[model samples]
Target: MKSTVEHLSPTRVRINVEVPFDELKPDFDRAYKKIAQQVRIPGFRPGKAPARILEARIGRGPVLDEVVNNAIPAKYQEAVVSSEDVKPISQPDIEVTEIADGERLAFTAEVDVRPEIELPELEGLAVEVDETEVTEEQVTEQLDQLRARFGTLSGVERAAQTGDFVQIDLSAAVDGKEIEEATTTGFSYEVGQGGLIDGIDEALEGMSADEEKTFTSKLVAGEYAERDAEITVKVTAVKERHLPDADDEFAQLASEFDTLEELQENLRERLGQSKRMEQATQARDRLLDKLVEGAEVPLPESVVQGEVDNRLHDAVHAFDHDEERFAEFLAAQDKTREQFDTESREEAEKAVRYRLVLDALADREEISVNDQELTERILYQAQQYGMAPEQFVQQIQQAGQIPAIYQDVRRSKALINAVRSVSVTLPGGEAVDLSDLLGPEDDAEADEAPDTVEGEVTGESAESTESAESGADTADSTEGTAADAKA
Candidate 1:
């Protein structure tokens, strides 16, 4: 067997391969066996017919078709593995060129290959991040939240208003006909919470006990979704929450702290830690932006288009691929289909670029994921999707998505390594040290970005949030390539 490569672009190549008939012995044996099992030959047991006999009965065309189909994939993989220059990032476009019967077989595979990227110097790459500070307002907000949890409700002798709890009866009618699904009696609701309907807040406010108000609101679900319905609400009672005073006594009851001042300080410390994590995340993002900007990554049109198609497929899948329903969804969000397509294309380009950049970094650094690291990442993502680790493993394995997730974890470790080498500072030029939060390079890693479909740029790629939400992106089935679903 022999192979040659033709450079189609900076990101794609065409491989020409030729195999002498002798190399295809294993493929022929398998193909003949498979075919024989499916067809009956008189006087021969099932699957026991010889290749020559099967060919005589079934004709050469069928046998050759089976052999060619089985051999191409293996030969293509062989050709790629033997070539030092080829690193395919996308599936190959295969075309069988010739079949000199009893002599040789030839074919060509055109695929998207990773470009030769001269990455920018990553050592001590400087980036600016925000200063970590916990404001008094933030502390106060935390204290108030704690207070609300321990608060008690008391019946109020006044009209329902914002923050007041109301016991009310609600019923709605579309075109004057009753909607049973939209009707409830003695439902407890907090005024101004505003999840029930659009106009409920305004209607509930200023209504005293035993008072009723009729208004119209658009129904959001059920049989009358998006339709305006006449709604009637009768207030049975109004109650207001009485929160404990923010004093030493309240501090003692709410937390282990003995004083309000102590409680406030604790909140401030926790917030500061949270802010430091934010700074680490921000630094990672900014450094990625810096590196990608400095690197020369020519986009692969085929890979970009594939990413775009996947995004569009997911976007419409929620509506069961019904264009009309999808349009309605877009309309609700004030986005047109053209705008969505344009944005998707733009995102696809960024995602592909990010993947290429991180891949290059991983290679340069010789980044490799151990089984333990891969398992940890898998477990984290499984929790993110609310599935047990075993279940998630089974799903990805069934879908042949292990490579996609493995790549994601590798990319994450690459980004973390980059973060450690880069310099981070505050807006005022003061150096910000994030070693504790980001962990040491030897012990640190995350799996949440392009995190692609890339579980991609905006969500997965370049977005490494190690502290707050660092679980990387969701893994889709690996793209089709040299091996189907293993690209």
Candidate 2:
């Protein structure tokens, strides 16, 4: 067997392979055995017929076809493995070029390959992050949050207000016909949370206990979705949260701290830590933007198209593949199919570019994910999806997505390395020290460090409170590639 590679482009290649007949004996044997089991012979038991007898019955063409089909994939894999520099990122388009009776077989495969990238100096990269500042008001807000957590609800003899919680009965009717799914009694809701049907807050405000008010709002879900319905809400009880006084007794009750001043100081310290984490997050994102801007990456068209197809398929799947309903959804968003396609293409291209850049960086830096790091990421993702780790692992394995997870973890480590190397400064030109927040770069500690999604450092202790909300912009701005790719 022999193989040769032709460079089709910076990000693609064509491999031509030739396998002599002697090398395909095993493949031929397997093909014959497989076909024998499918075809019946007059004198031989099932799967026990001689190859020549089967060939005589079914013809040599069918046998050769089966052999070629079975041989191509394994040969292609061998050719790929033999070529040290050919890193295919997409499935190959294969064509059998020639077959000479039993002498030799030849084929060619064209595929998207990982491109060669010229990496910028990691240490030379510079970025600016927001300076960490914990104001007195921020500390007070944190303290107030703690106080509210221990607060008791007191029944108020007045109208419902923004901070008040109310017990109410809600019933909705569309065209004077009641919708059972939309009707509930004794529902407890905060006055201004706005999650319960739209315009509920307006109807609840200024309504005293035992007061009933009817208002019309659009039902966003259930059978009455997008239809205007008359909702009648009867407030049975109105209660305001009464926070304990901020003194020694309150401090002792709320925390391990025995004095109010100590509690306030602790709150301030926590707030400061949060701000610092925010600063680190901002730095990480800015550093990534800088790195991507500095590097010139060639995106593989096939990979980008594959990603776009996956996204488009997922979108249409939500409407059960009904194009008309999808079009309606687009129209509701004030967008056309053309516009959506255009945006999806752009996003796909950007995502591919981002992945290619970080992948090349990982290769150049020799960044690798070990078993423990991979397992930790898998565990974290399982928790995110509310699945048991074993179940999640089984599902991922069945889907052949273990490699994708490994790639995500590798890319995350690469990006973290990049972040650590970059020069991060504050707006006032002061060099910010993130050593305390990011921790040391020892392998044992890095393996234990919380994994980042995409290119952002996330789930650090300081950022835990705001992790769900704060990283959203970074994730969205990057088009979810950071998290998806473990960037």
Candidate 3:
């Protein structure tokens, strides 16, 4: 077998492969044998059919077709391997060129090659982040979160004030024409929560049980059917939050902490830890932004288009399948999908570029994840998902997500390490501890790298291909921790 490659672009190549007659003979013979078994000859038994006799009876076209079909893929692989070009991550476009009796098998394959990036200087990237300390107010906020968790709802006979819980049946109308209405059997609302409209909350104020109130409010256009909606709400009940005393007895009932002081101290420590983590995240992101902005590279149009199409597909599915949910998401963001894509394309590009930059940094610095670290991270992630570590590892493999997680961990470590290498001058002129700035115990984990190439990944293309959902879990865990700390 012989192979030759032609460079089509910086990220693509075309390979032409030819299998000699000697190499093609084995497949041809195998094909003939298979055909013989399937066809019958007049003078021979079914199992004892001769290739020549079968070929004579069935003709050469079928046998040759079978031989070509069987040989193309194998030959193409060999051709790719034998050539001086790197094989593709995706399936190659294969085209058979020649196949004749006692002749060589020939084919061509075109595929995208991994780009060879010339990494820019990365040692002095600038990052601007909020390095504010965890204040008493922040601590109090954390404590409030905990209190909210243990708070109880109680019936009230007074007017519904801001922060008061109210039970009501809500209906919406346009020009006195009822559009929607529903009676919630037992509902609770925190008046200042802004969950219901401003007008509804205002009307509910000073309204007690059995007191009916009606008001009109404007609905944000597009998300809801009406441009501006007129809603009529009837306050059926009034309730207020009853929080337990923050003392030793409450502490004992809520958690392992036996005293309120102990709980507060624990909450303070947790809040401090949380703030440090946030600061570290902010610093890392700022540094990444600077690096991406500084570095210059020609992004493959194919890669960007692929990413955009995939994102668009997900967006379309979200909108079409769950319009209400999608609308709610848009409302929170204060923008529609079209508006978001236009405004956020630079962010998307920055994300792509930063991954590439970090990967290059990892390679330059020789960063890696050892087996033990991989196991520990995987186990930790499994525990987070509420699964046994071993079972979760197996599930990750089955779902083909282990590599993605591994790559993410590697890139994160690389980014942390890069930030650690820099000298940070804070706005207040205080020297920042790199280790603390990167996150707790990040230094120890930064040294670990994957042991095998099976899950080995470099370059941002594959990494970005992963689901953009890790941050959601991080946010949930942070919120939960905050709430637990307050308790």
Candidate 4:
């Protein structure tokens, strides 16, 4: 067997391969065995029929076809791995060029590949993030939130005011025709919370039980959408929330703490930790932007198109793939079809460039994802999707997405490494340190590299082919910690 590569472009290549007939012994045997089981010979039972006899009965064409089909994939993989410089990122387009009965087999495969990238010096990377500090007002707001959780609502025979809860019946009419979808009864709402509809809060204000007010507002949906409609809200009951006094007894009931001061201090510390994680997130994003913008990356058109198509597919699916509905959505967003296309293309190009830069950085730093790190990532993802770890693992395995997940983890570590190398500062020029948020850097993790392309440490994809989404979990955990602090 022999192979040679031809450079089609910086991001693609074509490989030509040829194999002698003697090299196909194993493939031929497997093909013959498989075919013999499917076809019954005169004297032989099941797969016991000899290859030559089977070939004679079925003719040489079918056997040769089977052999070629089975051999192409394995041989193509052989050709690719043999070439050290050829790192394919996409599936190959394979074409069999020749099939001389006994002489040799020849074929060609075209694929997209990663181009050599020149990385910027990591030490020179710098970014600025907001200073993180917990304010007294923020702590007080959190404390009030805790108090509100333990508050009780009591019935009151008075006009509803701000912060009061009310149960009401609502009816809407457009041009003297009642809108059934917009009418409801026994709906409970909080005054001043808003968001139910335009002009609702004002209509409900200063109204007592058994009192009704009719107000005109514009509807956003249904046959009378965007048209003026009259809404009548009848207040069925009025109630106000009453809170327990902020005292030592209240603190003990709300949490393990026995004093109000200790609770406030705990809330302040929680808020401070949340602020630090926010700083870490800001630094990671700004640093990534700085690094990617400074580097020159050659984008693959196929990869970019794949990403753009994925986005478009998702966008259209939301509107049931109806052209008019999609148009309305774009119009609502104040975007034209041409503008959407251009933006999607631009976003896809940026995503491809980001992944390429991070992959190069990972290569330069000899980054590898340890089992512990990978398991932690899986657990985090499982929690996010609200599935048990084993269930999530099974789903991903059936879909053959484990490699994609592995690539994402690898890219995240690469981005984190870049964040570690860069400088972060506040607006006032004070240096910001986020080691406490990002966790400590391990020397062995930094030094280790996957010894093989498909090794357990590396997982798969010797060279990653896509962008990563990470660092958002930093904010999520911070929020969880803040909630825990409240408890």
* Candidate 2 lDDT over residue span 127-210, tens digit each: 898867888998899889999899899898999999899999999999999999998999998899888788999999999989
Task: Report the number of the highest-TM-score candidate.
Answer: 2
For 42-123, candidate 3 gives per-residue lDDT tens digits of: 7876657767777778888898789888887777666655653353433466888887567777888876544555664666
Kindly give the stretch of ten consecutive residues in candidate 1 with the minimal lDDT sum.
465-474
TM-score for each prediction? Answer: 0.87, 0.89, 0.70, 0.81
Q: Write the per-residue lDDT of candidate 1 for residues 314-409, one digit (tens) a residue.
A: 777666677786777678778999999999888777777777777788889988877777787677677777898899889867755566666666
Clash count (model 3, backbone only): 9
Compared with the true structure, the alpha-carbon lDDT of candidate 4 equals 0.72
Q: Give me candidate 1's TM-score against the actual structure.
A: 0.87
Which ranges of candidate 2 are over 4 A from the true structure? 173-177, 222-230, 442-444, 447-487
Alpha carbon deviation, residue 321, candidate 4 (Å): 3.4
TM-score of 3: 0.70
Query: What is the C-alpha local distance difference test score of each model?
Result: 0.76, 0.76, 0.60, 0.72
Candidate 2 worst ten-residue window by lDDT: 467-476
Which candidate would rank higher by TM-score, 1 or 2?
Answer: 2
How good is model 2 by TM-score?
Answer: 0.89
Q: What's the true lDDT of residue 406 in model 4? A: 54
